[model samples]
Target: MKRSSPAQISPDFRRTRVVDQTGIEERAARFTKRSIKQSSKLQALYQVLNMIDLTTLEGKDTDQKVRQLCYKARHPHDELSGIPTVAAICVYPNFVRVAKKSLEGSGIKVASVATAFPSGQSTRAIKLADTRLAVSEGADEVDMVISRGKFHAGEYAFVFDEIAAIKEACGKARLKVILETGELGSFDKVRRASDIAMHAGADFIKTSTGKIQPAATMPVTLVMLEAIRDFYYQTGKQVGMKPAGGISKSKLALHYLVMLRETLGQDWMSNEWFRFGASSLANDVLMQIRKEKTGQYQSAAYFSVD
Candidate 1:
């Protein structure tokens, strides 16, 4: 029955002031080049990077591909030795059961995207029902996208209420609220989104859906992480963070890990607080792990990208 305070709601109603945040442009310009230097010895850092929870896959082909990836990650021998398994398998609601079946006894969590996913353009009743269905289907985690229209119109209360309601529907399963940060209009909006999500009972606050441009940029991520840290300082609750989309390269993932380390310290680097939500990014991490272990380039088909 927890809820966000009225002060955290949108503007002051009747004469709601428009919030302008031109300052984010400056911050983003500074961190746009987020890649780290690649060296022959960069393989040493691959062990600590966040293994992704891919959601862009589908159909029978994707299922088989993910099964192979899971096998290699969990049962690496010889060339695939020592690499860490991905944090979890992410899929649509219908596929949650399949992922659960595939990942049974393997310790990998099953995450499902719900709450009208990419569009989030539905009735609140339907959104809540979708969350319940995904959880009933056995998803260990649920990723729900906030209503961008509500957030954009300064309807912060609506956004916060929706998240709180969804959290209730989630029961024991963790709820990750995706801000789709790229569309939030400004850094303040992003920070506010992070705050609303966390205060409204989100176990984790995420960056993007990979369906929009300017998704998961380093500066925006930095801002979101800072918000998480600040919230923890105030409430003693540790909210997790995920920067999905546009994070495909191994170097990109490592840079994010580095940011998390420097910003939130080593405590948030684990799978519990950090997650990479990308389909193409997993193989890249695996490729780096393979190269480091074997000292040679592995074939594209040697791994799965689904």
Candidate 2:
């Protein structure tokens, strides 16, 4: 693989084909109109602004806090009457058991970050082992970061192979291939990575790890979701979409949901097809939901994403 910055990359790298972009546009417009008719739907979409994955805390012991978060999601009705929790709980491999135990039999899915997350510099053996370990620990899904080194070098095949191997390791568990969109350099690279991950057997194609600075954003997430819609058109298999990073507001979450609903339709509106990945986001969504129901502001300290 040879390394080149986004600017140095050629037109060949920038090319992507959306099979029915016009149809997608039309559907998006129609969904917007329909979404406006359902007040609850509008409220839920607004909660997306506050969805967070809460993968780690740099200086804190997150275990006790994480437990509290899981508890809160399970009992959202207690703190915020008639409000549901955020979509899912995302954590490290070791903590999947915690999330599993906390969310036992709950509708919310347990997603574990695997494949030498953050750096993604581990060997194949380590990465595969990590995936297997997480799935065996009761993770409903696994989020694995792509090998950025190979990707930056234009070794798409290597990157693809690694993702496929990890997917195989997931067995019955779903696999989410994280492109770490920040490191991908451009929309073209992001699109290419999306294609590579989907073709390589990703059940979901996510935007970032939430550990990087340039975490998931609307434009990039928009691009990735578009790629997902295109792939579904060609393959007839829907891949889930997750934008995990810096998405800590209810309003923003709504935008992504709006984007997804517009691009992929109501079929992708459920938790199965859409998820927000931020620790802070869950509480924000909860707060907004509370306001919608009670028409009053709630205390933030009562909510925890630990």
Candidate 3:
């Protein structure tokens, strides 16, 4: 079915239900309380590894670093058997070429963060150019930040237009719009932003840039998931979700998967529907998997530092 465009969505759509913050906190806490069997934990660890966007987004990102990160994405652990490669390698636009080259034929995608990244204060022309450059460099996916300044200033139209523009600039590349939920003030605002991003044609609505504090908390992620759910029901289009940053531990990652399964059902449980934006999360999950296999705790020293 042909989905409705962003223009067809009204302001009323952005006005999400008054978020129940206390209830949300309690529910999020309950997600962590649930435990898994050791056998199931091993399978979930592999699933976690495959869904990771092994990332290195920074001012210090180098060709060497990008290549190393790509290599890690391709071969998460040389010593481990039957370990699947990660979903992708996320890098700055300048390093897209290096990541693309290194990740060739590994079925690992190259993702670039454009639209001014942690801050979307730049002009649309500049942001489009940034996205185009990444696509030209072979980025399979483009992660763009929503204009938080505009969103906070009650400029919802501008925010929606910017994301739609970047989605066009991405060409054939998938677009992941980062809401930076931590900077959006409250869960209600987070829901509003998520609605805007999805209707604006975001293939994925992400929680953070991993640059902000309090990125991808369970409550925030739950709110975004709910937004995606409502959007899908209204438009008949499935938008992906990425809860980036601060999800470093394996147990936390499992809790996120549990949340994914419970909130959106198993249909949204795959990498095509969900992703984790982290540099060290791969290692932590790997360590946990190793621990389950050998009955001995593993060290961070053993895993490749990407």
TM-score of each: 0.83, 0.83, 0.96
Better of 2 and 3 by lDDT: 3
Candidate scoring better on lDDT of 1 and 3: 3
* Residues 1-306 of candidate 1: C-alpha lDDT, one tens digit per residue: 223433343333324222334554454454435555455335424543345675554445465665665554455333544455667877778777767887789787888899998889999999999999999999999999999999888788898899999999999999999999888877777878888888789999999988899889878888888888777766677889989988888776776776787778878868898888887776776777767666898777776544
Q: Return the lDDT, model 2, position 25.
A: 48
Q: Write the per-residue lDDT of candidate 2 for residues 1-306, one digit (tens) a residue.
A: 222332222223225553344554455444434333247744664445323344553336376766776776566546444455555677778877877888887676777888888789989999998888899999888999999889889788788889889988899988988999888777778888898888888998999887887998777777788888777766677888888888877666676677886678888877677777776676666666666665788888766534
Worst 10 residues of 1 by lDDT: 10-19
Write down the TM-score for model 1.
Answer: 0.83
Against the correct fold, how does model 3 do in TM-score? 0.96
Pick by lDDT: which candidate is best?
Answer: 3
| Candidate 3 lDDT by residue in tens digits, 122-206 | 8999999999999999999999999888898888889888888989888889999999988999999998998888878899999
Candidate number with the higher TM-score (1 or 3): 3
Candidate 2 runs further than 4 Å off: 1-62, 298-306
